[model samples]
Target: MDETAHALGASRTLWELVDRRAGLTPDRPVLLQGDRTLTFGELRDGAERVAAGLYGMGVRPGSVVAWQLPTRIGTVLLSFALARLGAVQSPVIPFYRDREVGFALRESRADFFAVPGTWRGHDHTAMAERLGARGVFEAYGALPDGDPAVLPPPPADGTAVRWIYWTSGTTSDPKGVLHTDRSLIAGGSCLAHALHLTADDVGSMAFPFAHIGGPDYAVMLLLYGFPAVLFEHFAMDTALPEYRRHGVTVAGGSTAFYSMFLTEQRKVPGQRLVPTLRLLAGGGAPKPPEIYHAVVREMGVQLTHGYGMTEVPMITMGAPDDTAENLATTEGRPPAGMEIRIVDAAGRPVPAGVDGEVRLRGEAVCQGYADPAQAAGVFDSDGFLVTGDVGHLRESGHLVLTGRMKDIIIRKGENISAKEIEDLLHQHPAVADAAVVGLPDQERGERVCAVIERRPGTGDLTLATMAAFLRGEGLSVHKLPEQLEVVDALPRNAALRKVLKYKLRELYG
Candidate 1:
């Protein structure tokens, strides 16, 4: 990690650019949270007041502030507020449970906590007391306070740990990924170029602002001098109306949100409220090809898929002009200002068409993990972040992800990824969703297990039937699942998205 950093502007931080934009696009909509709305100027002013308020509460620069808020106007302000003051913001996802929340708060050693006075109909005042964070501040609304604001001076010529975010603990303990102000701004630029965003565009975000997806995308729009409509949740009934109301052209969210929107469209035939909507993008997990087809065919909106992680957020994204094959298979090529390589277990670069661990190094990549020991564990001798994903990069610079290095199913001798079977499960007409995982077995170290969610009124999601379908799909004998669990819905996080295979492993495996 270099000690010095500089924003591409050579003189501005991300918040400074956003603050400048607030004055440029003063009357334009900056955020839309249920019944509430705020323009760019209003959002900036609100963030200033909130920053001032946080400062009065003794939130000095370099303070680790834990923001435990849901998606909304206030959440956005708190993020920029902390950034503007040079305080590090560690966000607790709104859907986090006691264990997850407690772990993050304690591990981050937060100096202050911010939350909505009320969230998702829950009283945050009571919730914060239970969570136990210092200097709890209430984010009421986008109103200006007459109190004097305290703005922290910039880092000594070269520093920016503006925020510390962790991975969505799908596999192990969340790795704290730190981003400097310069790197965060660079990340937004990479995403904006890949998405072809412009100042004339209007974006509607559904993924939580606390994570990489919303903050990166929202910053891209704001930095490019565009307007954005922020939503606190992914309620289809409300999201559709909000998009139509704001004439939003870009719809950003997770695979779960897009899947739910498709499900809703099927239920309510002939509902075209947001006809002017142009694009729909999904991330947070590998998207099944079927859902991609339905979104484009039915809604007549361009369907874009993104693949990234916390270590090197925005690694690969499907460009606006990528071919269907490129979009469906690879996660598009590495965006500008990024470099990628496929290497074997020994860390030697591999030839095209061979699977190996993917390593990435670039401006978008983080300097190191927050935990020194964790950083030593993942960082290689050559200073590259070893992403545990098993994939191959072609000569054309496109990548084909075979599976994850850690998610492979080991049978008697063969190693396999559950993604192949999950893709096959999507081929089933009655199967709404599926996740394949490896379960311990007495006979073979580990065996395959499939957890499936069947559509309403659909029956016969039996283990034997699914096996037959896999066989028909040409799955090998050893690759077949030894057990199947059909349920009304798979267990998911607060976002109502499923990827917690570990949770299922505890329940059924």
Candidate 2:
């Protein structure tokens, strides 16, 4: 990495880093949506004006402000405006409804709440008023504005908790993950360094701007001085033209995104889907090894998957030059200063190649949850955060995830990994997507159920056919799926597009 990029990791505050980058590349585009371009200089000047406006409304340093906005230039300006004032900001995903949004607002005790008014046929302003939210206002078309002289100096301390990002509530209520400016910077540094990006490369943000990745990606752009295209609503047909127009070189959100791009490529065989695209990289969901090979061989683009969560946005990432085997089978290696520990049930460290709970500790890790009660049981004695994922580290320091602890299915006292079966199923020519879930059963304790979305133009797939395919792949007979259900599509969330397994269990259990 270059000296300027390395120096970004040492920035004490998010606003400071923004200022430094803007000064270096004042005229370069920092954010783009449609025809609206936000140059580095405009980003700083506009945010300060909005900060002054917020200050006029009695928002001071350390004040709490929560916003649920879509992916737009206005949203980016509002976020930076809050950072300029050093206010504690809580960003809720635009797709989250009352249940999750109410919990976040109440728990965070936000003094102000910003919404997009009417978005995607939903009236957020009405909901905010109905929920009795304090300081409810719209930030879609235009944000509050005032004189910059009214604002105080930007915050100097970076260790203070200023960000509260919520987890996706798949099985239960979400928890608010607390973060500092330094932690976000550290996480972004990991991603920027691993990708080996240059200022000339163009990126894209297809996911929600409210996600933890929003700030993580913005930090990378600030450090590397590159611009990224933002999508308000991302669809394959509509997004391709914009990507091509801007010459997007790096594009990906997660494994689902990779699959989508691959599917598009298959439509017109022997033609590159996105001609300028060279790399597909992201994290947030488990990637099947076969999917990696398909992208590299078919699309002719390098696929480098990674491992991360809301608590720590960027944990481990695959580099562009990693070995094919390592990139396919492993989630890549952690950068310098990140410590990954695989521990047994009793909290003892396991040997390399042994599957266990994944624990992480580093500058990038979140401070804790917003609710103190929820934070009590998350960290180990040595300060490592206990991640519920089950994975093992290879001797070469690469991470190999098996599955989640709660995702393991126990049938007749034998444990079965859902990810293992899902990975094998993904290799099938007829299967477009598959999720293996355990259902309650009186005879075997729990029965293995395979829910699949078949590829277009494929014939019906019965339980017998799936079982036979698994057997041919050398899967143990005991691990064979006992039930099968083919659906049009798998249920997924808005951000990261991760399959909502809990919803699948609700339907199939």
Candidate 3:
């Protein structure tokens, strides 16, 4: 990290960081959305007023508030307002419906809830009310406003669990990953420093702000004093003009994002998709080596992919100065404070160049899951978080992720539990057995594929029917299977008779 960013990153709390940045560069824009701009000073001032309004609404320090909103300036203000009030804030993705939203509210025990009312043809407020959420309020256009004087002192402690993010971790339901302000700062700081961003660089947020990457990107902007264009709904056609308007120098979200831009670039053989775009960098799902080479060769820009998750947003990130071979093959190296240890199946540390489960010990690691039982056996005795990802560290220290030990499918950087989908599919009367797996895709990073064994004499099933059934079962739309294959029987082990998912992947992938 640079000396100035390192010093700014030392702030104890996110509120402190905001205050300090506002004091230094209050007039500089921190967030840009269409014709709207939120300066650093306005962010601090607006959040304070919103905090006072929330205080009047009975929110106190340690109060739990859950919000399900899109990528808008108002959502940012609301989130920072919760921070200013020292309230525990949980953000749910906008696409999440009753099942996921209800799970987040119940698990977080949210005292209050924030919704966008109705967005993208969906009624969020109605969904919240239907789920029996407490203290439901809409936060779409204009946020609550009040005098800043009514607010209490901003939080001083940064180690307290203030953020609850959801992720499917080898389970049937999403787990609440607990995080502290300091831990998030550490994660974002690593990302900012590794990317080597500067004040002159213009960034773009083309993904859901409710994801863990929201705070991670916000911290980067705060530290580097840069502004990023916020996209509520990202589509290639709609976002191209905005990128040009904002002069986006850095663009990317994951492998999917890179492929989208590359596809656009290919539309015109020699023309740049976005004239100002210079670097495309992100990480969530695995990046195929060809995607990296294609972006560099075809897009005429730098492409860097990394490794991250909801538990730890920035683990290792590819730097702009890294060798092309390293950038194409590995996920890059960890920052100073992060410790990556690859271990064998027996839990013994393995030497470099050998594949094993990747474990991490770092300040950026989350406090653990909200459910105590879910956290059991998550961290080893040495305090390293046992990441279910299997990878190896090269001699140059770049990490190469081979595969995952967990049964989660990452599609467009979102973790989808194969078990969750399979369990839901098993409930169908015509289905005898089901297995879900992720297949390689150039655009989505991975596409969900469900292979099923039909009950004898049962009619054949189509993907559309299976999807409608899952939707009726209250499963999130994003988790619905994209491809379906009917099989006579699922391949199984001879001894235990356990379904072998690898065989399904080989057959369908």
Q: Among these predicted structures, which one has the highest lDDT? A: 3
Candidate 1, residues 17-108, lDDT tens digits: the string is 66667766788776766667787787777777777777777777789988767777767777877776778888776755454456677778
Best by TM-score: 3
Q: Name the regions of candidate 1 deviating beyond 4 angstroms.
A: 1-12, 34-36, 121-124, 140-158, 168-172, 267-273, 407-509
lDDT of 1: 0.70
Weakest 10 consecutive residues of candidate 1 by summed lDDT:
1-10
TM-score of 1: 0.76
Q: Whole-model lDDT for model 3 versus the true structure?
A: 0.93
Ranking of candidates on lDDT, top first: 3, 2, 1
lDDT at 64 for candidate 2?
94
Please give, for residues 460-484, the per-residue lDDT of candidate 3 as tens digits. 8999999999999989888888899
> lDDT by residue for model 2 over 104-125, one digit each (tens)?
8999999999999999898999
- State which candidate, 2 or 3, has the greater TM-score: 3
lDDT (C-alpha) at residue 59 in model 1: 78
Q: Considering TM-score, which of the candidate structures 1 and 2 is the better prediction for this target? A: 2
- Flag the better candidate by lDDT, 1 or 3: 3
Using TM-score as the measure, name the better of candidate 1 and candidate 3.
3
Per-prediction tally of clashes: 1, 0, 0
